[model samples]
Target: MSTQRKIVFDAIGSVTTEQYDDPHAALEPGQVRVAAKYIGICGSDLHVLAGGHPFAQPPTVPGHEICAEVTEVGPEVEGVEVGDHVVVDPIMACGHCRACLAGRYNLCEPPMVAGFRAPGFGRTSQVVPARNLHIAPRDLPWQVLAFAEPATCARHCVGRLPESARENVLVIGAGTIGLSVIQALRIMGAGQITSVDLDPTKRQLAATLGADRTFAPGELDPAETFTGVIDVVAAQATLTEACTRVVAGGTVVVMGVPSGPREIPLPSMQRFERDLVSSGMYVPSDFADAIAWLADGRFDAARLVTDVFSLEDAPKAYARAQEPDSIKVLISLSD
Candidate 1:
């Protein structure tokens, strides 16, 4: 057996690379071993590293957004073969749960995310269930495939809004998810798309990605409103603006995960018949749509990727990801 390297968040302020005995000596049935080509650092991973993630804390392996190549296949695993490029859907759910039975497994009871609730894909090579792998176009760059996970999240968020509410959309927070939401909206044929972010660099990227307009924190007119509002920054101020700025009877989709409970004015929402909904991780269909979009050139994943670091520079990658101007930071495990 050989050794493999993996990154671990040993404590709130520490990130270290450690070696472990290769686990591919034997593969469990229905599992496949994949060599990670690229892994995207997600906001949730940073949250866990900062000791603010509600579920996952320090002493956890932090990686979920990944693009990998299959190296070995276990018994009973079909449809996936070695030498295939794939993206991973990290949601792990028990088939018996009501949410799973209804095909809404993203909301499974005791929701378990692979990188958080279970072992993650941060290692150079790891074994995952074959079912979670979605084959991607071999011709596409591995960096683009790394976006499959986050793009699925944007797909799910846009899917929550009705077609009528999509004509004019307002997206708050032009971060990775926000920029992704802009692209998803464009692919869905939205009428006019506007994005707001404090960072000028992100605002520029949002416009380049497909947002028809971009605004700073206070640049948008207070009286102007939209048919739909997507809050990618679930802070109290942004949430309040989303709820209040949406037109009556319109919808407000919350895509950002808050650190703690937030106060929403239910009475006003009820009085105005405004629907405030939220989107969780994503479903299999959403993941498929994200992959298809990336394959067909609908979603441009390359624009959002701003920084890349080698596996040994995991700490540097995480630090760059937190920078105000950096959009998406990736760790490359292979060529």
Candidate 2:
């Protein structure tokens, strides 16, 4: 049997690339085999690498932002065919669940998400459900296609805001998601977009990505308010600041995964009549829109990719992803 290279985590805070015999098995019905090309490193992957993420278990592959070329399709697969480039939506919602039936699959009681709870896409070749793959523009760089997932996540965060918040938006944390939010808001024709972060590099990148202004955490006026305040870093301090700085009747969208239990000031929120919503996985429509946005060249998605590594350098890729200065790190399986 031929061998293929893959990154694997055997225990918490451990990572390694190993060559294993190719499965070379026939495609199961409704599945498509992809020659995985690029996989973007995500904060969730870093969390799992650091032994902190609750959903990820050891002895699993750890990547979700994927771009690949379809090499084979199962008998029943219809939309995807060989030679097509695509991005995979890793959200694996059980269609029969009440939340899914109600069109809120992101809120499924027992969450089953790829790269988080289920098997991930961090390998040379992978077989995924046909429904999870969305066709990509063959012309776009593989790195840009790899961003469809995170961009879809950003779309979900901004989509949850109220109509009033779309005009004047404040985004916290100029990380990948934060930068994605800036671009998404720009595409949506937002009025004023201000990004807040401690890192000057990220702040500058945010401004380039369409933020009207970029400020360090301490530079923003505590008394200043906006129609929408998105806290991408959902720690207690940031959450408190978001609730405090939001205008009365405005919306506060929490997109970050809180490190632990958080206490929201119910009295302040009630008094101001402010709205708060937590953002999670994107819906199917959001994924489609993300792919469309990338395909149409609505924004420079490639600008966000800061580093790339081969499959054998998976450990280095994760380390670079953990750096505060790094915008995006990707594993290039093909290139």
Give each model's clash number. Answer: 0, 0
- Sum up the clashes in candidate 1: 0
lDDT of 1 by residue, 11-83 (tens): 9967888888884568989999999999999888988899987788889888999999999999999999899
Give the alpha carbon lDDT tens digit for every residue of 1-335 in model 2.
45777888778878898888986889889999888899998888888877788888777888888999999899898978799998887877787888889888788766777788877888888888898888877898788888888899988888898777787889989889999988988887788998999988888889988999999988987678888989999999989989888888989999999988999988989998998998997888888888888888886678888998988888888888888888889898875
Cα-based TM-score, every candidate:
0.97, 0.96
Candidate 2 structure, TM-score to reference: 0.96
Relative to the unseen true structure, what is the C-alpha lDDT of residue 19 in candidate 2, on a scale of 0 to 100?
82
lDDT of 1 at 219: 94
| Candidate 2 residue pairs in backbone clash | none
- Clashing pairs in model 1, backbone N/Cα/C closer than 3 A: none
- TM-score top scorer: 1
Candidate 2 segments whose C-alpha is farther than 4 A from its true place: none
Model 1, which residues run further than 4 Å from truth? none
RMSD of 2: 1.4
